[model samples]
Target chain A: MFALILPAVLVVAALLVGPMVLLARISLNQYSATQLMIEATTAQNYLNAVADPYYRGVMLTTLVMAFICTALTLALGFPAAYRLARMESRWKSLVTVLTLIPLLVGNVVRAAGWLGLLGNDGLINATLRGLGLTSEPLRLVYTPGAVAVGTIAVVLPYMILTLSSVIESIPRAVEEAAANLGASAFTVFRRVVWPLALPGTVAGCVLVFILCMNTYATAVLLGGSQFKMMAPAVYDQFSKGMNWPFGAALAFILLAATLVLTVLGTALLGRRYAR
Target chain B: MGQVRAGPGPDTVTREAVTRMRAAPLSPLAAPALAGPGLSVRLGRLAFLAAVFLAYAIVFAPIVMVVVTSFFDQEIVTFPPDGLTIRWYLNAWAQRDFARGFLTSLQIALAATAIGVPLGTAAALALVRATIPGRGFINTVLLAPLAVPAIVAGSALYMFYLRAEDWLDMDIKATLGGLVAANVLITIPWTVRLVTASLAGLDRAAEEAAANLGARPLTVFTRITLPMLRPGIVAAALFSFVASFENLELNLLLVGPGRTTLPVAMLSYLEFRMDPTLAAVATAQILMVTILMLVTDRFVKLSRIV
Candidate 1:
């Protein structure tokens, strides 16, 4: 049994755990122009990241954008998930497959699709022009709105799938009993379905929120060069700026933010709904 | 409205029967019967259906838009005036970088899937069947890579590889071997997740019975457990392949200058030009993934694992 698990443990320890440990160590080091990174134990890199307005703004933008996208996806996904869960029609399987389609399509490809739809000369602008709704093409692409839409498109399927599976487990008899007791549809949902589905909803939100925070391809493609986010900023620091220590610090910050929020969100939601 | 009471009156019984009938699986739109029958209820159902349709439309619009834009006859993608043509697909195929990148991605994905699946399967089996203490901790560690942001993981690996190259007195960063290692790291998590899920549904009676009958553990595992785990292993392979193939952020920092993956190549092209050629490439990927998924579904229900 130990032999069976040894190979995977070794690989993970070497590849994933080793690098992360190194990353944590490097984040506290000093950045030098010629040396790339200096061996030191200083919190300067983390301080610079938090203190600098540009990096701070990037963090804030990422947080705000992730929150908005999470809210939007949950709002849009809950109904679709509920409908899919209770659906008895033959189209249920077909619709479920359709939902899975976007997940299989990689983010870069999906981002490319968004480019075709939201670009200046893309579909939406052309359609607007054809309909005589606008004289000039609206600036759809490279806007925060485009980024939000792209991110939501990427994450909504995950939210829906998670919620639907959870919703599917809640017995139909419970809802029927609530209805028979003269509760309205809203009341039935609020009293029975909502409480039962809370755990799944929280799980979905955490998953989607974390995904949103780390969004890279969508943010780059849809948000463009001017737009800044934590993931892209971390990449730019490592690749273009040659600031390894700062990049490591930024990476840790992003990871911490994701972890902290996920735990916090789970705790708050879990506590509120705890019986 | 007053007919449905808590007591077992005849009116209440009839109402319950009607509610049960409405909730039956035969109803095409079996919405919960919390609402009474009326114009308002009909309108609400119509609205709910429309919302679901709109959600699906949003989900598919980007994919459909890419395929549509790929056929635009013009050099630049303007909407209405252009005729349809397959030239963009030809153009995408003509790009040397894309072709090379596609081959690189294919090689890497295959290699990653080959190496990652078995390791993940073993780990999952051990976690499931063995009496290992701290199994939960080990499981979390195995799946941690999936939660770590790809860019963070990529850069961390890049830095680590650079350091390793210095110590080992050899090149590692930006090499094909290093990229495969990184991809394998990612593929392991998916395999662990799917295989673990599959293992949860498995029956242990066969293995126990085989053990009782004096069969060697290896023989029992190879003959019975492995055969039963076929669907899970296959699904894991497919998913791991897709995960490696479609990876961009992880491969972004790790890829060498000349050794770009297809997605990285596409990103580079997008930076330079906004043509239908990339659209053509994206459409091909979409079609390929769709077919792969549909074919896999024919064998194993992905919903069960995914």
Candidate 2:
């Protein structure tokens, strides 16, 4: 067994655990523009991150946007997931393939797609003009809305896929029994289906939320420079600012926030389920 | 049946049609209330299905637009183009950076898949079949890469590489070798998950029977286990290759000069330009992934990929 697992352990230790430790070490070191990082250890980066209003604002925006995106994804994805779950037709596999195609497309490509549609002179605006909806094209790109829309598109497949399987696990007979008992469709859905699907809902939301929190390309491409989110900020610090220590500090903070929120959300959802 | 009577052959046919139609409404199994109890409910259902169709359209529109616009005869990516042509494809082909980047990405993806598959499969075997304590924790640790943001992983590995180079006096950072390592790290979880699932569902009685027949463990594994794992291995390798190929954040951070991958190259171009050439490149990527996925679907149900 040890022999079987040894290669995996080595790879994990060398790649993930080792790099994380090195990242933490770098986070504690002094930032140097020329040498990448100073040998001396300090908490200056963390201190600055905590003290700065800009970082705090960015953090808040990241949290708020992530929450909003999670809610949106859940709302938009649920119905489709229901369709996929209840479907018995041969079209199930076709729909499933359609759902996963976006995931297969890289983030850059997805962002590029959004650019095509969301740009001022893009398809939507051109259509609206052709239909005479407005005199001039409206600005949609590089806004918070664009970011949310793009991120939702990015994460919706995960939500749908998760909830479909979860809902599918529920026996159809249970629903049939409720219907046979003269329960309204709404009541059966509300009382029988909703409660049973809570765990999947929680899992899917948490996953999507964390993914939204860590999004970089979407924020950079869709949100643009005017909007600053956590992941892009971290990337900026490390790559553009040449501040590895500060970047690492910011990354750890995001990690902590993500973990804390996930746990808190899960606990809250668990309690709600019990109720 | 109660009021109408047949007079002749034509009247008899009309009576039969009426009887069949009347029987449909009487049969509860044939006509559920949800299908059309009231105009409001029917309209609501129609609206719901329309919304679902609209959602799917929204999801596919962007990807479809990229492919459609690639054939635009104009220079820019405008809708309702002047005409259809393959000029952008030719332009994309002529772009040397994209060609080189495509080759580089292919090389890296192939290398990463080659290294990650065996290690991941071995680990998965232990994870699925081996009797060990704390296997849950091992599973979590092994799959933790999925949760870690690629940007963070990239930054961490970039720092680690720099530090390691300082200590070992070897230049490995920003090289193809370094890329392979990072890509392998990110991709192993997927391989392990798919194979572990396949291995879990497998019947291991054949291997046990072989052992009972006095076959050596290695022979049993080679002849029995490996053959059983073929489908999973193929799927895992495909996934690993795609994951590595589609990766951008890590490549953006670790890619050296003249070593840009296709995604990285696309990102840089996107930062500067907005033309149908990008549409061409995206179409190429979509086509490649679609073909690969279709091939994999022949071997396994595509729905199980999630």
Candidate 3:
């Protein structure tokens, strides 16, 4: 049994763990423009990342945006998930396929789709002009709003899938029983469904929140070049600035932030619902 | 049916019973009106259905926009007055970068899937069948990559490759093999997840029976366990291929000149031009993935695994 698992263990250790350890080491090194990177032990990279106002603002923006997207996704996805979970119509399978189609399409492609819709001459503007509702394009594309919308669209399916699977297991009989006992529909949801689906909600929110924080292509394409996020900032440091140490530090910061927030959120939710 | 005779039965009646009562052929008037939902409930249901419809519309709007833009005859995509044409697709095909990138992506996805699936299957089998300690810990470790941000993984791998190049005095970064290795890392987690789920559903009695009948362990695995795991293995391969093909952030840092994958090529193209040619490219990709998923679902029921 151990032998059967050795090949995978070796690959993961050598590729994943080895790289991560090397990255941590590199993050402590010093970056010099002439020599690229110098071997040294220093806290300068992390200190610079933390102290710089620009980087601090970018981290904050990423956090807020991630929170907003997660909230919006939950708001929009829960009803759809409940509908799908309890669907008895013949169209259930067709609806499921439709829900899944966007997920299979990559984020880059989806962002491109948003580009065509929200651009100056794109669908939304064209429709607005045709309707005589506005004189100008309204600056829909290349805005923060566009980034949020695109990110929500990309992650919504994931939330729906996660929540629906959990909701499906909750058994319709329970909800019906609550209703039979004269509990209002909202009451049934508050007292029954909400607590039952808390675990899935947490899982979905964490997953979507992580994706939003690390969003690269959507932020780059839809938010335009001026808009900065943690992932793209990390990319720019390595690709354009050629600052490996700083880039490694930024990557670690993003990873740590995501991990800490996810753990904290899960713990808080778990504790609150434990009663 | 016997409970239908109880007084004020609306509280006890199941939804299916009401539906059946409404659908009964012999007595249309016998269907109880009181069992149906009240007017407010009906209105609320209508509102919920509309909300669901709107949600689906938002989810699909961008993808539909891309496909629509791809058919526009104009060079620049302007909505609501363009004639239809397939010229953008032809133009996309003529672009050497997209062509080369598509082939490169296909090869990488294939290589990654081919290698990652078997290794993941073995690990999953060991974890499921063997009474190993710390099984939960090992499972978490295997799935950890899925949780890590792709950009972080890509940067880490890029830096690690550079260090390895220095130590081995050999070029590893910015090569086809290096790119494939990165892709394989991402694919393994999906394979492990799907195959593990599959193994959990499988009955071990056949394997135990074969062992008791004096068949070698290898023979039992090959003839019994592997065959039962066929659907899972196939699903794993399909998903892994899609994952590798669609990957952008991981390949963004690892790709070199002339070794760019399709998503990277598409990104660079978007940076340069906002024409419908990219839309045509994306539409082609969307169609291919949809068809592949539909076909795979025909055999494996993707809803079960995904």
Q: Which ten residues in a row have the lowest lDDT in candidate 3 chain A?
A: A171-180
Residue pairs clashing, model 1:
none
Regions of candidate 2 where Cα sits further than 4 Å from its true position = A33-36, B1-35
Which prediction has the highest DockQ against the true structure?
1
- Weakest 10 consecutive residues of candidate 1 chain A by summed lDDT: A168-177
Query: Which whole-number lDDT from 0 to 100 does residue A205 have in model 2?
Result: 91
Candidate 2: residue pairs that collide:
none
- List per-prediction Cα lDDT, in the order shown: 0.84, 0.81, 0.84
Candidate 2, A1-275: lDDT as tens digits: 87978888789889988999889888899987688778768889888998999999999999999999999788778778878877667888878877876877888888888898988778999899889997788989999999988888888888888887777666555555576677766667787777887788888998899999998888888887789999889988977898889999998989989999999999998897785
Superior candidate under DockQ, 2 versus 3:
3
What TM-score does chain A of model 3 get?
Answer: 0.97
Q: Please report how far candidate 2 places residue A196 from its true position, in Å.
A: 1.0
Which digits, one per residue and each the tens of the lDDT, describe model 3 over residues B21-126? 5433211111112457677766766776677777777788889888888999889888774699998898998999999999999999999999999999999989
Residue range with the least summed lDDT across 10 consecutive positions in model 3 chain B: B1-10
Instruction: Please list the residue runs of candidate 1 whose C-alpha ends up more than 4 Å from where it truly belongs after superposition.
Output: B1-36, B211-214
> Using DockQ as the measure, what is the rank order of every candidate, best first?
1, 3, 2
lDDT of 2: 0.81
